[model samples]
Target: MQYRHLTAYALLSLSIGLSACSTAPLNLPAPHATETQSLLHLEDQFHLNNLATHFPDPLAITPEMKAFVKQHVPESLPEVGRLRYLTEALRNPRTFGISYHSGLTLTAAETFEQKHGNCISLTVLFIALAKEAKLNAWVNEVVENQDQELLADNRIAVYKHINAVVQLPNKQVVVDFSDLGDAYLRPQQRIPETRAAAQYYSNRGVDMLGENQLGLAYQYFKRALQLDTGTSYIWGNLGTLLNRMELYTEAEIAFREAYSLDNNDHTALGNLERLYLNSGKKSEAKQIRQVIVRRQLNNPYWHYGIAKQAFEEGKTEDALRSALRAIRLDNSEYRFYYFAAQIYRELGDRDNYHKFGIKAAMMRKAAQDAE
Candidate 1:
């Protein structure tokens, strides 16, 4: 799953654990459980900090942007004008364009000021702007293609998917930041405002976790879970957070909860496998490895995950090889192209990077045309 930058709200990625396949996993039952002592303290002090701090209001609209929306969307608007003003214009560099930056979760004001953000950031901006225009719009976390990658902190972030849904007087509009030609955000489920806010915190938590800010990340993840306990991915991510803390027991419980919520969620299962192996349960680890292998066959995302891992390890050739394999398996996934381009760029192959970049741009156009 991958979110496309430059697209308003492209549905993005998710990754289950992959350590289950390690021929020899690391030692487990972590010594001192990392920071478990501080964790208990956080359990108490964390509650003292209100959820509002973590899930702060992301819809802070600026007066200038509000006025811009007002000027563009009149009470009586032409169909073409409505479409242009609401979608194209906001992203057109020559106009009131917003830049697309991946791996971020920005509030509306942040997006506006920076003019850049990931899919969720763009979606939140869209929702805020649409509301300012007196339009009915909301955020939706639709079923999506998940893309997983290793972060700077050696943690993994399965980029979640989000989009903005606007109900016009006579038509409904879906604004997505994606390049693939998928018509639906898979499940197309409507997410309430509160749940969307919770996601903001969860994504930020992922970022913080990658930065090794365990306490801060824990607070964000906890708030996210409290706001929307049903999101299996959040539970899975929470498990990852706990694992990094070396809190194996707590991590296991979180992963199990995630697995029970979404049996097919390989990420949770993967984390569980890691936990078992880390704790010296080789037999259990082997069992999980078998399951992961069975579930990965014919799954293009598996190849994509390998590509990401290789890239992280500075294996450009391997990354490109795996990326090409992923494309061969599923050319419809635009994200593979993005990775391919990045790989080429890393190798100083400017021509190849441009070639793949253009291909990705063309696919994005294809998606927009289909839309």
Candidate 2:
């Protein structure tokens, strides 16, 4: 985990776009906001000896997916209301549709074949079905802050929540796989399709990096940034990757760009703080840490973050208590379920682990069912 050599010669920062008329990334012009840009070519980032598996195509819509929708949905469904009918149709198990599969990025085709996936994968699945039914559909991402997950294998997955948004002539409906009703909720900001695709690829890259597949991960991250460079976390991920390679200068720049893009990105702030602390910038490091402490005091997720730290420290009881406290602060957050599962595992309470696992599954299902 050597880090201290990555410095961008220059950077091309892409502007964030969110409007009623969002455009396609393919048609998007290369952003040249600066005189020089970092070498963003895929070849520069990838040099794998074994490049057997290619990246999954995000826009893929297979015939199987379309035909499945046709077989279940009535052909005579009025064009304007197809989205609503399909939504109801998905809720029935007899209709031969979606189930929940956790982890990784699966394409619509893979999800359709597998019959289940996590919210991100499920949303892609649902949106594909909606599009086949002739309804306008796209992935909708909710604005998230201080919502990050520390996954297995030293990998961190920043949460950029996704749900299906189907546009109707009369109304628009949101299809969520993690229904958090009347719970503490955040206002959603729908991302363009390309941005959504970028998120998927970025997450897949995270998993790949966890596997130590640096070459493939680099490719994935490049593609993600190419699709939507405005994503702060994606840049942060790139910075983290560079850090692992000991590209500290480049990593610092990347992290700062991430924080600049989104002030709430404590991950970037934390990383920057570490860099500054190591570089003898004690005051700068402490200032960032203080900001985080002040913010976390009011953030409901503060307890969960503490719980994660406790779990890592091998303090079972403290972890469990903190995890529970997080739930007490906000019961609707699914991350708490994950923490509780970890605690139960540590306590060797298989029954409680299974119970909480089932509870989490059901909560996700209720969201998918939009119940």
Q: Please report the candidate that would top lDDT against the real structure.
A: 1
> What digit string (tens of lDDT, one per residue) describes model 1 on residues 127-204?
898877667788876665443332212234444567877776677667776553353434577888778877887788
Error of 2 at 91 (Å): 4.2
**What is the C-alpha local distance difference test score of each model?**
0.68, 0.65
Model 2, 105: alpha-carbon shift in Å?
0.7
Clashes, model 1: 18
Off by over 4 Å in 1: 1-42, 45-54, 78-80, 147-155, 169-171, 179-187, 304-371
For candidate 1, the per-residue lDDT at 266 reads: 65
Please estimate how well model 1 matches the true structure, expressed as its whole-model Cα lDDT. 0.68
Worst 10 residues of 2 by lDDT: 1-10
After superposition, which runs of candidate 2 have C-alpha atoms over 4 Å from their true positions?
1-36, 39-55, 79-81, 88-91, 147-155, 179-185, 278-283, 298-300, 303-371
lDDT tens digits, residues 1-371, model 2? Answer: 01011000111111111122322221112223341136254344456535655767765799887887787777687755576567666666777555665564677788777776666677777777887887788776665544434221112445555776777677766667764441213467677878877877887777777788877777778788888878777888877777776667666777777777778766776777777777788877666666655555445576676678778889989988877877887788776886798799889999989987777777766665663
